[model samples]
Target: MRAVVFAYHNVGVRCIQVLLARGVDIALVVTHQDNPAETIWFDSVAALCAEHGIAVTTPEDPASAELDQQVRAIAPDFIFSFYYRHMLPVGLLAHARVGAFNMHGSLLPKYRGRVPINWAVLHGEQVTGATLHEMLAKPDAGAIIAQTSVPILPDDTAFQVFGKVVVAAEQTLWNVLPEMLAGRIPRLPNDLSKGSYFGGRKAEDGRIDWQQPAQAIYNLHRAVAPPYPGAFTVLGATTYVIGAARMARRTFADLPAGLAVVDNSIFGVGNDGQAIAIRTLTANGNTVTPEQLQQALIDNPH
Candidate 1:
């Protein structure tokens, strides 16, 4: 089988590996150049393609006439997108002789838009998974081909959950590629009404709202922790990024909804009188220990 792949990140790398392992002739790989402003943490699809001697292009726009012509010239039997940032145009998708499919970070039709893993964690979803589906004009509103569920533990960070989703994407593609190559495509309904769609998140969205419930605040912290931007709150003139936090066993009823030091441990007192123990906190890229934070709170008890 012949294919043109549009991919990026670890999921892209692993899914491409699956295609290569299954003996698919990858005619071209379309990927993005790493944004210099963003942290480049994931495996590169371009690097993997180079190692395998596959043709690669880093196009600014996948829907351009130039790219459309290029894919049409290849006349690939299939087109697969794994974690590619851009949505392929309908014209571009039509270039594939068989079909074009995409791998999404969450099961359809839930978490249908951007940053599914993070959104799942933020919403305290116990389970979120990878979904392979046909590419349509609307983003992630396609018919499901395959899905593999994975657990989302209570304290699982977005980065950790993303690891599981990447593995799930690999397994889903690996298990279904042979059948797809044999022209036995699966088309399960992706009911849009039954699902939710979220817009892309910004770093500012990680601003912690102490007025929320303790679990909600903790979920926000987990959702954007570490590799994703850490959830943050302002204390006087300084901004403190919450690197890690968990619900406290006890409430601090007397404390206002904000940061507090209770028995030497830094806690976030929520509006519901519940507390969240701040495990790792930072300010200006420097770790701020409980003692330091306590002193700061004491110095500025506004």
Candidate 2:
């Protein structure tokens, strides 16, 4: 099948690989340029396209008239979007004579918006998956073609969960491509009423709230750690970023909600009277050892 692919990130790279392996003629690839301010940790769809000699474009606006003409010129049989940041306009979708499909990070009818993996981890979801669905005017509100689910361990970070979703996206597309190629497309119901939609998250969303339960606080940390923004909290006029944390196994008497240091381990006592062991902490972009945190606590005592 001849196709125009709008893709980005590792999921985009792998999904495109699947299409190529299936002998699809990728007439064009639409991708985004890596933002200098953001961390570029995943495989690049542009690089993959270059290796295969496919034409690629990094347009600031996917809906521009020029882009519309470009896509129309290709006259692709199908259109596929995988992890592409921007929404493809209906005008672009019309260029696909066969169909326009999208591979989403979460199961259809659940977590159906931006950064699905991170939202799932933030909400402490037990499971999340990838779904390949028909593209509609409304984002992620389309008929499901196939899906592949993965488990979310209690302590799994957003990055770890994203790795699983990438594989799931690849598998979901691989398993369903043959049926689509044979002109037998499946249209499973995507009950939007049964699921929730979430907007994109920001760095400020990582601010930890001490009044929350320990597990909730830990979930926040896991949801935005490292490659994503680390969860933070202000203490005594200083902002501390929590790089790693886990629910405290033991109890401590008379400890109130907030930062605490006992022996040499740093802890964040939640309003629920529970605590989380802060395994890695940082201040002003510098790592703060437990000893340093203890000394700070001693000097401040606030």
Candidate 3:
């Protein structure tokens, strides 16, 4: 199956490798000309493409004249988008014989947007998954070809979930590519009513409001926690970045809500009418005990 693949980041390249190894003939690859995070390396894709001599383009827009010339020349049967950042234009879609497809990192009709895995964990959902669908002009609103769930255990992190989605995406591509390229792809329309959309979360969304339910606060923390911006709170003049934790009440007398019960976790009023706890935290270039933060409050009264 001849295809034009647009991708970004290491995960994108990994998925590309899986497709290529499965006998999909990749006509070209498109990504940012430069990467802000050094981690978004093309070494893997570059090496493979070099070995195979497949052309790569860093198109500002997939429909640009230069990009159009390349695609028109290759005339790929399909255009596979795996984490492509830009909203793909109709001009590009028209260039492919078999149409274009997207690999979304969520179970469609659920978390449908840029950061599905993060939003899923943040919303405290028990599970999420990967989906392969026909791309439409709208963001992530497309007919679904396949989906596979990844369980969201209590301890699961976005990073871990990201890994699961990667596995699901590669598997989905393998399972569906043959049918897709053959012009026999079987897909069902997404239930618009059933699907929900979420916007990208900012680093500020990590701010923990102590008044919120312990479970809700815990959910937000988990959603943005580590390998990410992480939850933070302005204590006096210092900004403390929160990490993982559970809900617990140490003592009614000494424990302060929204304060740490100990070195254990972030404190809150659980909906169950008990104290709450958060496990880890960092602040002012120092990782300290929750007690230290409390003492800071006692000393400075922020």
Tens digits of per-residue lDDT, candidate 1, 127-196, equal 9999999999999998999999999998899999999999999999999988999999989999999999
Residue 285 lDDT in candidate 2: 89
Q: Which ranges of candidate 2 are over 4 A from the true structure?
A: 298-302
Candidates' C-alpha lDDT: 0.93, 0.92, 0.75
* RMSD of candidate 1 to true structure, Å: 1.0
The TM-score values for the models, in the order shown, are 0.98, 0.97, 0.88
Tens-digit lDDT string for candidate 3 (1-302): 78898887555676788777778888798876666654332335555567778777776777688887888789998888888778788787778887788888899989888789999988888888878888888888878998778788886778777888788888888787767767788888898789898887788888877666667777777777777888787868888877666656444344444654444444654433455465666787578676787687787652
Order of models, best lDDT first: 1, 2, 3
lDDT of 2 by residue, 160-235 (tens): 9999999999999999999998899999999999999999999999998888988899999999999897999876
Per-residue lDDT, model 3, residue 199, is 83
Query: What value of lDDT does candidate 2 attain over all alpha carbons?
Result: 0.92
Full candidate order by TM-score, most accurate first: 1, 2, 3
Model 3 residue 72 CA deviation in Å: 2.0
Q: Which candidate number has the best TM-score?
A: 1
Off by over 4 Å in 3: 33-53, 249-256, 263-276, 300-302
TM-score of 3: 0.88
